[model samples]
Target chain A: MSGEPLLEVKNISTSFFSHLGEIQAVRGVSFYLNRGDVLGIVGESGSGKSVTALSIMGLIEKPGKIKQGEIIFNGEDLMKKSQREMCELRGNEISMIFQDPMTSLNPVYRIENQMVEVIRYHNRNLSRKKAVAQAVEMLRLVKIPEPEKQIKSYPHEFSGGMRQRVMIATALSSNPGLLIADEPTTALDVTIQAQILDLMNDLRARINASIILITHDLGVIAEVCSRIIVMYGGTIMEAGNERDIFYNPQNPYTVGLHQSIPSNLAISEKRLVPIRGTPPNLMYPPKGCPFSPRCSYTMRICLEEAAPTIRLSDTHISVCWLLHENAPKINGYSKGKIVDRYKTPSGS
Target chain B: MKAVDDVSFHIDRGETFGLVGESGCGKSTMGRTIIRLYNVTGGEIFLDGTNLTAMSEKNLLPFRKRMQMIFQDPYASLNPRMTVTDIVGEGILVHNIFKDRERQERIFELLDYVGLKREHANRYPHEFSGGQRQRIGIARALAVEPELIICDEPISALDVSIQAQIVNMLEDFQDEMKLTYLFIAHDLSMVKHISDRIGVMYLGMFAEVAESYELYAHPQHPYTRALLSAIPIPDPDLTRKNKRTILRGDVPSPIDPPDGCRFATRCPLVSDLCTKATPELIDKGAGHFVACHNV
Candidate 1:
């Protein structure tokens, strides 16, 4: 726990060479994940959260390529690994679960076949009977009722939530040190989402796996993540612990996101202040901060130059010109001000 | 086997009645049935005390102008080849409300109301983003000057920030035009924020119905309580403190749903009575209604 991080992504840039132009999906994104850390990367669609995950998994194909930077995992640079080496390390050391379980799973194969194959793939010497038993135990760990019976069912026979549970079981069957889940619950209903998230929390403790959860819902991040990374236009706008990002947010995009969503705790009398304009286009990304177009406190400098990462604390960092020393102070943008504003009830 | 079975509700003038449920719960079906997209197989639908279900196509032609729908997928709903002007002005031309330059002017005004520029009229739907295309859809719905607009998961396909903008615009339009809305969505938080009254549907039946605040604050039905508690609160502190009621398994299929209560298969408080007789929606006083044997 005191040594280097379990995974460190250093200034990685990924782009797709489209016919029109180069689509810069992940532009110099850097982050680290420690042992047992549940890091949530929160961003909207086209923000390149999924692309970053795919790049780390070495799954980016065709026009897409990881142009630069290193992905160090357990003292080894994953970027230097051969495709054969990556295939060996994928299920054995790192596991991933995708958004839609139906697509990720083979419809023709039974759940037992998928889980057994993954289990046996990681451990070449394991007997088929032992692998099947381990598969049943994994399904049982995820609280799937009648695991032995249900393991015989096809992917379509399972419900959306059950299929996701099966996916989690299959992902964890290898017992990888790192689990990268991309929008794991976005396709399921809220009630089932709660179930899957709860199961993840339970499994994280039991398996001791470090998780990188990627999602567009801030609420989901707040629910599970110990640390949060706010991404926009394929760049990290802010990275901090949950409290720093939620209660004492420094980035305008982070604050704007909190203000935009209607809180279930609060009644509906006041209008939500929406961030105007759409997300930045990646093909023709802005030279300065990606949020400068929609930022309420944008200055001339914010649009002219890219913002440097400002360290507010040991754990909190923000990429915004407003955090600069020479920048003028804006009301309600001060430290810990958002907590007071959200604490007060809007109305009954 | 009915998509929407034995559901009765009324929307008062200028009131937004939200219908919320998980996927395949018939909320969308209910919305379509109200707008006559799906013919009513069993029950009658009345609009302002007029029986819409009994009217013929020729007789219902005028009523069609009084009701319109905004679809969920902006990418699929809007005609790809049609320009924004044709998309919005088609209703005006069809209903013969305006013509030529006047029709064009009305289309421009509707675009402005929905936060689109005049120059956007000539561009096709493919050129616009999801949020912008939804605005175009809104403009089209408003062009007919419909009193009741059925928004079928309009903001579900949008991002959170853009969702707020669209919700705020819908609110403004409702206030300005005194329009009623049948807002159907699976997002509980946004639905609660925008609705006056909400109906909780499960397997083609209304499980709960009450004022929005009442439904959220003191949810009575077991299904309603589980659904509300399941929503992840945005505030970290609140989310940590919240004791969620995590339901087991997925919702049972609507086809040949377990006898009596549709939720009986998943309800934590299920009893023998719940398996034998379906509960009726009984008033729990203060305009709140719940359908459950335990309640």
Candidate 2:
């Protein structure tokens, strides 16, 4: 718990093997992601938050496996590497950005041969004319305005916010050290999902990198995470500090994912309180608190076991048993339009 | 409850109007210019009093078969190798209305009046579910029995648990088929719960029309007060005592659009006579309207 954790994941677990059998999509899911931390995982939608970012980009596939986890990163464990060393640490040292940028850009290639073959496969002393002039200067550092003739056009000639700024300029042209971003601006348009979350917060402060961000949009994890985790069914359920998971949310599934964020406030019955049922089926999931059957403070030891984490600070934690140390002190997570969610525009 | 800017508002004769906004408002070009499905250039639509911006799709196909449409990607508006009885009997065999096996028993009685399961009568829209491919695109515009249904953003591509089951089956097929709706959407609180006068579009026109509790109780244009202050409100203590109106920029391109009030380039009351004139819907007080030179 003392720094140096740039991306861990311990208990891991991620099953799929189907023919109606194994299904767990990331159960033991531990966390950690430092260096300019962005984190956010959130959930809903087979809530494994995109199978924990495709099990940290090893990009799990065959009836999706990673049956146990480790992932690690800097001290190297990315689950015992090799798919050619997890494809040269996937996009060279971690990078993802999915949620449909027109199904990952390649309508018969052209954004300069898909970002100069990702800077000639992560730099082989560049030069297909300097990797198409540095893929038009990384598509004008992803602000993408006429990046030299919009890199001779094609992923349907941009716009799904410039094909998610050319998939965030091919996930920041291989200058990666973590940047998963699954629902990367959920198929855009909220002012191009706030200009691709201000171009992934100016490419995470010009590539200091470290972001995980998966989403189900709690207003984009309260505007681009500083730390959130939540997840459901495939566990994790809470691990705070995006102001204790959006304002002291002590997990009731991060207070129903901050009461399912819709809030532009003062609502007079155009009502949607939603979050009632539909999530529990990692192929027959439910047992001990996978959000205790849509939890309204469920008890009787939340149907047989599981609720340990609790912790609260040294950067918050939670499994649930309503943070018990003789429980109680509950009530908090209910503020919205981000209750001035502690004035954060990066004041962290 | 009609006053947010209740002017020129008229959907009458079975009524659904619902326009709503956000996601680059224009309410799908005002429901494709009231189902001329785009042409209008400037104003005038008036259907039953017939202006339809001076008709002509062969006199607007007997007013486009009484104005029928219903899209919003029920898997890209059905046709995946068409089948659900020829995508709901291809608009009753293209408006010929009935022929083979009584157009397959009127596409199995418009798929059992939109509740489907006439054994999903030979299916395919990727084998249905996005509320049964929007009830086979509402039995393909109720197999052209149309009395005006535009719909356009129909359940904004489903899944809010099948968007309240395709908005309670488009309000029970508009209360047992009286049917009339423009209903474009971006979900301003489900167009104030299935509109009866809502409008508010922007960038392509109409900044307020009202009557869904008077445009969510008093909204008057500053782009319908930043689109009913951006409809989220699921509640976490009223988004902690509200204050959203965050409309700074973007939504300016309708090609050559901003000389004078195409929401004066993102209006937070922009005025130098709202960039010099083009502001006319005007009325104001009762059937409200507001094209805004400061309302």
Candidate 3:
């Protein structure tokens, strides 16, 4: 909305080549992140949210490749960078925290060794003693008590929440310009997840760093993100500010997701309206809108070709046939609630 | 070590009682123990006032037909090699609930009842999606015509939209058949929505037990209060405005847990008395129960 954004991912498509077929994980996803902005990418399994994050980090492994599009970070195209250059950028300028902390961390090594190594690698001029001290300071920033003493303990000694904190500390040790957290609080308890979310909010303001938080939980997204991208079947179904996405969601998939969760705190005797049918099989993905098969207001045109992106506002966009200018008007599908909720057919 | 200890609760004939806690909090163990899947080290479980713990394997056969459990992971719970027909009808055949032609018809009826087509009966578990697999699991569980169903995080693995479908289906079945349910899950919001009553477990003990509305509106236990506040409401404004009692540290390891109270280590209002003498679950009023020294 302001000056040049911190990171801009343009028309990126990532796919995995298997014997069965090419599984298009992320297809033509485009979004930008401004400095100090917390962007949330929300999607369920097979939505390709995680793959989009990996594509940005240049971490797509064998059989999986970024087919096209440029990843521009701080005015430079990251796709042009060599492997050596990408390695230097990772964990230094751009860091990522995964769903599980145990897998990313070294079990045998002490917390100090892992953190200091990351610190020193990004800043070679810093002495080991200074790096160790910096490591403890980072640990303290994440609110891990007794950082100096805890640094000597192995990853196994810490609890799930504590281990996640250590992971965050290590990731932020270099003061990375952008942080990408994929399902950071998914494995944690509700109380522990709240603590982490609060800490992340505090640290965001303290450091003024941009974050791309990828998660499936809409509640988690509401708690932390300023802007939200709702993904489905490897494509973005809707993109808007938190208010637009939550208060006035336009896309059928987005509406379906909202209706599915029991959000009202009143505890009324209301039943949930689940989106009928499973996600499209990516091996033979739809010829038209990815969510067309499961969408309630699917028009004949929706099954023939892709839905046109309708700009609801300067900051809100939804990809759905119902939002199109010439599309048939449907009643009672407004403000994220469907009128025929109970009687919504369970797919033909 | 006692996976579940000092936990006493009862479920009405046709009510859903939610058991909620973090991982390794013995919620699943409690569910399994009630269904007689796990051997009880201590305590007794009664189903319709009949002591299930006292029954031997030979005598337990009849009781086993009356209760069933739906697991958390749909991917892991179903047999990969088994056909849907066989999987759903296995229990029917085991208990001799139906004959040759009737069994086939019953299997198709079950598939249809769970929103699955009769054609899907020939497919393997690998052919179905997570939600469909869960339906198949539900069908298999229902095949025995059990009076009680233990849904152990049934919708946790499913997507948000699909979760509502499964929940609504369960509710519909509950109303139609009047089946009792032990809904065990970590997600508090859904639990509050589904359960008539809820039990909040910390380590091996319930911190609070009350009606769903009572538990959410006025949680008495210190642990329950913090937990209720911790849930990130879907509304952005409400979530931001809500003042959360963020629990400082991790849940203390259940192994060799503190003598007096398992939650004392992380409890915000923990007093010396809490660590010295264990608090008993005492009824406050209106069928509400809380175990806390401070409250």
Residue lDDT tens for model 2, A1-348: 355677777777789988978888778777777777887777767778898788888878898888775777888887876788888778877888888899888799788988888778878887799888877888888767668887888887566778887887777787787878788776665545656676676777877788888876566666657777777888886766766766677777666555443334334344344455456767778777788887878777876676666564567766777666555555663222211111111111
**Each candidate: RMSD:** 4.5, 23.2, 4.7
What overall lDDT, based on C-alpha atoms, would model 1 receive against the true structure? 0.90
Listed models, DockQ each: 0.86, 0.03, 0.79
TM-score per prediction, in order, is 0.97, 0.34, 0.96
Task: Give the lowest summed-lDDT range of ten residues in model 3 chain B.
Answer: B247-256
Tell me the tens digit of each residue's lDDT in model 3 across B181-234. Answer: 999999999999999999999999999999999999888898888898888888
Give the residue spans of candidate 1 off by over 4 A: A334-348
Model 2, C-alpha of B80: deviation from truth (Å) = 24
Kindly give the stretch of ten consecutive residues in candidate 2 chain B with the minimal lDDT sum.
B1-10
Error in Å for residue B79 of model 1: 1.3
lDDT of each: 0.90, 0.71, 0.89
Which portions of model 3 show Cα errors greater than 4 Å?
A331-348
DockQ of 2: 0.03
